[model samples]
Target: MPTPSEDGNASATAPTATKCDSEHTPQPQSVCEPDHRRSVVQNVVLIASVTLCMIVNTANLTGVSISLPTIGRDLHIVEDKLQWIMNAYSLSSGCLLLFFGRLADLYGRKRLFLCGCAWLGVFALGCGFAQNEITLDILRGIQGLGAAAAIPACLGILAHTFPPSTIRSIAFSTFAAGAPVGGALGNAVGGVLTQSTEKSWRSAFWFLAGMAAVCCVGGAFSIDKDEPYQLDDRRVDWLGAFLGTSGLILIVFALSDGSVAPDGWKTGYVIAILIIGVLIFALFVVWERYLERVQNGSGTRRRRWWTPPPLMNVSIWGRANGKLGVMLIIAFLQWCGFLSFSFWITLYYQNYAGLSPILTMVRLLPMNVTGFLCNVVVALVVGRVDLVILIVIGTTFTAVANLLFAVIDPAAPYWAFGFPATILAVFGADFVFAAGTLFVAKVCLPHEQSVGGALFNTLTQVGAAFGTAISTIVFNAGLTKASRKYGVEVHGSVANAPRPAQLVAYKDAMWAGFAFPLCGAILALLFLRGVGVVGHKTGPKVVDSDATTNEKTVSHPWPTLLLVYQAVEDR
Candidate 1:
């Protein structure tokens, strides 16, 4: 095996055996190693290609929202069934993330990435051709599965390829920028397509399909190959995958379907599914813990068919500083606020403001533009500033933005309330997302990078689903109350509600949206303190005389904090 030098370059010659090695058997070397070096242009191409994939994925997420009304109208879809357009994608994507992340590590990042791109392209085209709501929903779910496969591998590839250097930081920043950029483009493109008489909503799906195809071709040529890493004697956790996916799907279904259920939350099917989902989720946690203990235990015992390597490194969460746990919670809450804003704002423009799809996109352009511009600033300042401080600031902005939305009148002028709110909301989200991604990447070990990325995105999707469900519930309740009070004829759907009822329901839902970010800000302030670096020692330490003279130990005051802070700055 080639030995790595101080600069992380692998030497061609193997090290000569010393007298000490002859005296005592040497330890086995690790199977994993970095790939052969590539030129600067190659690295850029790779980064750009992966960033394109990210753009396509995020664009699909937000772009579809703008096209929903058109799609529902064309397919004759009821309001109750409309949620599935987004929920199917979010649910499948969220549930399969960890499974695919682990699979990428066990197989190969490049292989899975290619497969995912192909799957994404195929299904995206399928979605464009879908004849009915059911077909479209199924296709969208499959498309999400493809996205889940690609996302983790993209992150892992970036993490492994770049290392801890300026290039790596730039790569991550560029990657981070894709979300907002794609979202902006998605909105613009969706609106333009929906307005086109010939293609309408289906045009958006065709565009995504073409984008994915280009990315797949570019990725195949650009990304460098690496050997797959697998733990000895361990196998894939099929049982855990089944339980986790099923439970999440059930839970999301319960929450989303409750909005349209005959009896709402108290509906027998909704209540039963919710209970079963909760129980199954509880069982999934217990099963994961059991498998974890087995993996960590001494000696090779007879392994059960259900047992597999743990999906996540439980130790990462259980670390003394608890930064990982805090980050996870922050991601969950922020996404809740972000998605609530994204989904409802479009509805507000359409139903209350009485804007066309193109007009709604035009009005919401400020948020997208702000998000894109702020991400550029984040890319510039990320490493120099403290990550916790960035997070706090971002969440603060998010809370304020949501609060503004909660109080704004339906007739409020664009410049007065809408523009400022848009700017603040997007700015906060971009900063938090960019900083949070770098923090997780810096903290995780090389092998765990894919899973780390998976965890981050899983929480994001699940949080979005949660936000949509909660907002729908609140909005529906408000509509019912307002209708009864004013004696307006009530329907089960928001789209069918009277104008006054829609406005009232939306105001109440906006208040709930405000709470998510506020809670996130409070949590960050209370728990996010001090930088804690894992695996590396901090500060100076005395050297022992008996220790080898060539051995070196580098330390920082708090290594985790410094590394993450530096990582952000370098970006």
Candidate 2:
């Protein structure tokens, strides 16, 4: 019932209303108490906690590769069954991201974040004691569900705590930095833990469990409980969530299990499941649309929208800038490039270069450092640059890196082919990740940010899952062909195989890995076109706006809620 006062401040029980661009000026009479210092500390803690979760989540994705030989040997895991270790986590985490994002908005970000940490820690501990591959795989899936819950909420919380353009840009930069940082750290930790004589690979799980426990304790104590608005207390779109989750599960299941299935791609079950997933996803969209319409009818103010309403906003999607849509596409494409390297590069280092897991991890440090630098620099420069041009340049460099990798051979020198490609790819990926994330942060109003961020991350994981699934198929098929043509025994350790045979299979698999980033480059380029047209910026040079729409749309002011926003304009 409260509205903005003459001076653009809100009294008790009312929300402050101001244009988003006017955030620099302090406005009194605001309902919410401002605590920039505590908010920053809490945000930092949130990052560390989420980074811990991400480390385990992504490490488990690739760590299984390093330990596959040992696991298979010790547990008698068959060739086909070993994949469940990775697939279980991918399917569970990727599918449930949107669900958790909405839950954070409905209940509380800190609450769900703590819950996810508990779930992840417990499941990680369970993995340490798992008796069989099947049990471990199931536990991995549970861990992924917890990660799915925590990650999006972490991002949403960051979105809320740092609503100002400059701070939001920095927060997103930190968030994006976590990916490459976590990825590199995961490999390093997995390598060290796997090398331990006392515990072997199980040590990795225990270490992760311990890390999650620390984060849980820190997060529970550090994060602030104050929120700008009251919980909407609306019903969760259970049917929509069900359909969407089932659809993704079916799709990923088809992708992951298809190659191992008896009939391969032609298998009836695979086809049926994929078809079902697609159909259900379509239904979910329609259901969400109906829900949106119903909510719009029930509320006069768009700010009073349903709790965690449909992940996508049609208004934003239809806008000329289409920043949200571009972000979705970038999430799909950028991750495609990143995940391809995550899945395939390890194989290249192992089979072709004959490096130990530890050696590979060390060799990858430069790229990770480069990525971190790029992330930091891009975050600093985001407010000054044109987004579309920045994305174009970065993605183009990524494509070039992928192309270089496609043609790499055993005789290729590390400095010439590998080093440059590593640098370019790392820089490109880091830049694109930061820019795309900024684009999303730029477009959203605060109330919708949690759900919006959840959607962005969901697509990111989905894309990575798809990219990994497709790349795995290509690598396996290519290896199979090279084995037959070169008369090499492909199964078992490549270390024991003939040099020529191993080299051929490794190079062929590397070549096949190009499919993902190449496709990513093209898709990202397509989406880059519309980035700055609708009152948005569009170039490589960083240019600050003079109190423009870019800042105006960054955050929403609510009179009924206590959210602080822009101050009154002189006009």
Give the top-scoring candidate (lDDT). Answer: 1
> What are the candidates' C-alpha RMSDs?
6.8, 6.7
Tens-digit per-residue lDDT, 1-571, candidate 1: 2233432222323222111122232322112124477787888888888898988988887789888777877898865466678878887888888998778767878888988888888988898899998899889987889888887788667655664677766887677678878888899999998887588888899898898988888788878776665346447888788888888888878987786787768899999999999889878877777776676663464456666776765655532257667887888888888888877787777656868889888877888778878877775666456767788788777767777777887666888778887888876577767677665655543334445667777888888888777877787788888877766656556655777777788877777778887788778777766643211122111111221122223221112222333445544
Residue pairs that clash (backbone atoms under 3 angstroms), model 1: 382-568, 383-568, 383-569, 384-569, 533-560, 539-556
TM-score of 2: 0.79
Query: What is each predicted model's overall lDDT from 0 to 1?
Result: 0.71, 0.60
Pairs that collide in candidate 2 are 15-559, 384-542, 384-543, 385-542, 386-539
Write model 2 residue lDDT over 1-571, tens digit each, in one string. 2332432222333222322323442332122234556655665676666556656666666566555545655677654345557667776887787787666655667787788878878888898888887788788887888888777666545545554445545545455566667766777887677765467778777877787787688778766564433434445667777888888778777877776677678989999998998899888878676666554554453433344456544444432355467557766776666666655566667546767767766666666677778866764565556676667667666666666777776576788777777777776566665566545544554444444556666776777667666666665565556666756655423544566655555455445445545655566567555456211232111111121233332223222111111100010
Give TM per candidate.
0.85, 0.79
Residue 162, model 2: Cα distance from true site in angstroms: 7.0
- The residue ranges of model 1 lying beyond 4 angstroms of the native Cα positions read 1-44, 160-167, 298-305, 321-323, 384-386, 441-450, 531-568
lDDT of 1: 0.71
